[model samples]
Target: MDGRAFLASLRTTAVTRVEAGERVAQVSRNMGVSRSSVYEWLRQARSEPQKLQASPLQGRPSALSPDGLHDLATALLAGPESAGLTGRLWTRELVNELVSRDHGVSLTLTSIGRLLRSLGLWPRHSLVTWPDGSARLWKQRYAYIKEKAREQDALLMRGGLVDVGALLPRSSLPAAPFGFHLAYALIPGGPLLFRAYSGPANAATFLDFATGLVAETGRATCLITAPHPVFDLDECARGLAGLPLTVWVRSDGDARALRPAPAPATASAPDLRPAVLGGPSTGLWTMDRLAGHLSALFGHPVSTGEAEVLLSAQNLWPEGPLPPVLPPGSPAVGRWCHDVLPLFQAEAGPGAAVRFVQEVPLPGGRTLLLAVSPDQERRFAWYEEARYQGRMRATTLADFTRRLRQDLAEPLCLVVTDDSGWRSRDLDATATTVGDAFFCTWADGCGERVWRIPERDPVQALCRRHFHQGRGPAPAGTASLEMEHPPRGPVGTADRQVRIAAAREHARRQPLSAGGRLRELVLAGPPALLTTRTLTALLSRAYGRPVDADRAVAVLRDEGLWPEEFPSVEPGPWEHETLPLYLAHAGAGAAVRFVAEARLGGDLSLLVALDRAGETRFAWYPQARYRGRMRATTLVSFAGLLLDDANGPLCLVAADEAGWKSKELAAALARRPVLVVAAGVPYLCAWPAGCGNRAVMGDQCRTHARRSRRLAVHRARSGPLLDAVRAASAELAVARA
Candidate 1:
């Protein structure tokens, strides 16, 4: 029953009980009204005799006539939205507006209230529930994206459906609280809220969601419906300033009559930051993305402003943007020359130098001839059990030591091929003494073996000296093995690192330059390795002397290795600036192909060979950079050499800094504009037309410095016509009388 009918029945029961001699408390219980209320009604009945009667406010005329009242009740029952209101809730003002529109009766909110009381209808703010069909529509929208993305290479296209829902119960009145929002995004991970945000959702929630959608998906689209009044999508579209996000607001329940969302206010910054919102470039409580995440997590909508407040209060990023991560893949130590520059530690291949192959430097003028060969067992294998089957070599210790001692004389050792299945026959005897020869069982990776002969006992070395030797393919039917000798000379971890760099340096300077042609070779590489250390290391290894690394950088930059506009992107783990991992693992031929196909722009240019050095002087203006020059190097080294005309001419010459350091090369260096004649590394120097950009002359620098020091000399002057002289590191600034 309505409030009026219920009140009337209570009055009737209370009056009847009072007349029947029942007490006020008993009457109150019977009538379900307070005792004072029953007493007041009984007194009114005794005095006026008609006050307890319920006749619907008899004698007073209702502002909304019975017909108007009936129409208002009908309109409210049909919902405010049906009667042309913003939302589904009812209010006195909304009822007033409804009466005027549907019944042609202008009534005040106060009069509407009285009419509502008479018709068993009381005003209330309706509870907010998940919008009808919103979730299903949201899912369907995402499904559509997935399907369309398949045709579009799994990319999120612009102008797709976006749905956001957020629930915020009012602390004061949760039954019908004032907070509810929609989750907004077509992406799978929905908008999320900052942790510990229990307060009501607001504009910030939606803002946060929208911002994330624009950034992550690069989508500019939205869907609007009439059920929610606060979300004015056309007005909301202004947030995505730089993106192409388009907002579509549903109008009149018709598909074609939709209103387009408004454009953003101004242009936004470029999307140069990382993919995630909480990256270092982004704020701790980046409102837009936070809203999106929270909405998605809570299965409700979160606004950008709501998200911002929560985030601002607490820290979202305890650390900076996460390091690049990749899926786990492992087949440890396969090729020995792959990632981490493997061939450096233990050398056992053909053509390796005698020094590199030896187990250690024999004490005081002692020498040992060691055999070197390749492990063809792992020649075609990359990693793990797949390639490890045939790498083991079985041999008894006693038998091997007998052959070594027989072949070599006193103070000589034999490093053999015993990578696998080599162990001491008896553990009790650590060192086997046989006829003044000490034999210790030792093995290394890639099927390499070693036998040590210490002429003197109690070797004072803690660990073995790490060395690599051997080179070139073996003769018919033989493995290309180098020195696989083990010794007692200790090599620490730091020393190992330094030696690894040195090994790569040796290979790059020697083997990489060993190709047939020099002048026509073009070295196309990434700009990342055009630095001082790498170039100096190259020349030093090639020339076998210390070349100033800084001078090398200056020369190569003159040779056109300086990238004008360097592009940067966050690299994944096991990655480098100039080279892709796939290319890094591939052979030299594959690398050449990759660089040729790569449409590099900005500073990432191919090193071109400009001129071949003449017998009398360095090549007259080395002005060309190419890609064919890169050989026998890891692709991720960010360098390549080429000799193709497909790209524009790059004036860069690659040469050993030592070779180009003569005084005669200066004449050639003075000729070229935008000249890049690198002393050590290919495509790593720039000696432009003027001295405005520094040029590093390898050997010529010392000669020039001596000359400059002489030219810099000047006559001394008596200070203030008295007794001091000057001209050390200063100029005269002479004033003539």
Candidate 2:
């Protein structure tokens, strides 16, 4: 009964009992109601307003009025907070509370709930909620989805189907909790078709199924699928020529239509409480709907339910996960389509009018009807026995019938060359040994050779079980035969090296000049840029040809194969200007200190050492200034600041600093002339007579001191100047000795 009528009946009973002066418990028992029920009814009667006894409030809205109730329900469903409420989700209790506090109208908790139920507003599990703001981002970030759909549609118009697979939320599938996917494709004649899979899905597997379809049917406008690094899209640009791409977006129900009513409120419905109300992306269902709308625009019935099934089937089937293993697109599934379509065509061969069926697993672990051929029942009866005896390897009923068709095409008949013994009999047919075995099974229920067969001839029972009683041409010869082997070349180091060298030479001749090709012969990637250490690793396995690091380095250098300049630098106080310092003193002195410092650091002065023989030149320079000021100085001082080494003259080359790297340093060094540094010391000449006569002075300073010493005695003045010169000369001689 309606809640109001039930309440009114209870009130009448409660009043009658009270007027009769009856006890509450006795009255409750007589009325077949609980004491609480009776008490509640009495309470309702006492709390009733004078509306029944007098005039009702004019134009006052009713708490349970159809219009007001619908408004409240609609607002709560949209989002509770949108109705000026505190929470995003509405609980029945919360809804009741809001209604009772209406200021002018009030309702009982029971009445509020009854009103909602009457208005078809019962509570339900929340639908899958995608990121709140994804819808906005989709148009910008997911334009690819539309582009792919359009391409797919265009292909379908020309008689093609684009196969695709995707993982969608359970709400989208509404079939299983997890592992379920959506497999879909576009057909020229109509909209998309779909199936489901409850397992792992990969690009290769998806492509394998596509290949089957293509090989079966020669009908495809274009292939389309969600873009994946491995599947729909190629990892390299070279693999993308003449290819199609797809886009998969996460969204809720179609953005264009109403979603299914929230799942019925029950223990079975899972709670889907989102952590945030409005976030980055909208729900997957919404995106799915948007995808559907796009698909629909292309004259395809873009359906959410169909999309879910399509993705699921691709994942469940074998070979669907192994994408690109066949071809870039689903050429395999396409092949399957090509093969099957012909068999069903009007011009198909005789006995080709059989039915086809597929056995597929349901989402809830149940096996159910998927597809069936008109002749499936008759077809199954003929092949079921052979399938049971292990003569056929068909797992499903439909598969069994397919195997039977193959058998029927080539029946295991006894070919009699001379019909002499009981020509009317269908038995004792003459044929080859293996063919005879199969013919005997057709006539005698099983091949007859157990007792007469020799033990060494393993084909005795194997031929009967594997090749007998099936449709196919018989083998040409007996089983006893030797296996043929492919030819092999002489195995030795010299031969392998010859092959490798030839391969390398061929690679070098290629127009691209890609180092990767040469490296692939020895290792992988570019080989020319490899250091001696890396090169040694590639040659380590060559027989009898041991590699000495020093010898290898020299050999490569002599051949101009190894980098002439090691791209390394020493730690030095001389900054980027280290190269110029070394250039300033380009004679013999550059050898002793340059060798020790460069080895201790990295090969920093490579450029300076290259031009160190005779020319006095400098190139490397540090050009940055502090504020508006420029501290111009000798190259040596500038080198000291740029490099880590303190005592050495600047080299025209800046080696990579031991602890620092700068493009500026490299760019500055690149402008210099090449120089070589030797690892030896020069013979010392006699000490000069001035500047305290330090014998082993650097080249630039040594010459300056010798000139100054020669002129010092002659340039002296007569009195104190001459006396002072004599004293300085005496000190210089003493310091030198």
lDDT of 2 by residue, 382-474 (tens): 111222333222243334323444535532212111122212233232211111111111111121122232234322322233233233433
Residue range 51-156, candidate 1, lDDT tens digits = 6765565685546543354345445444555677754344566676777776677877667656654543331322222234455566666565455445544434
Give the Å error, residue 292, model 1.
Answer: 17
How high a TM-score does candidate 1 get?
A: 0.17
lDDT of 1 at 554: 44
- lDDT of model 2 at residue 712? 76
Where model 2 places Cα greater than 4 Å from the true spot, the runs are 1-290, 295-529, 532-580, 583-672, 679-737
Model 1 scores worst on lDDT over the 10 consecutive residues at 375-384
User: TM-scores of all models?
Assistant: 0.17, 0.17
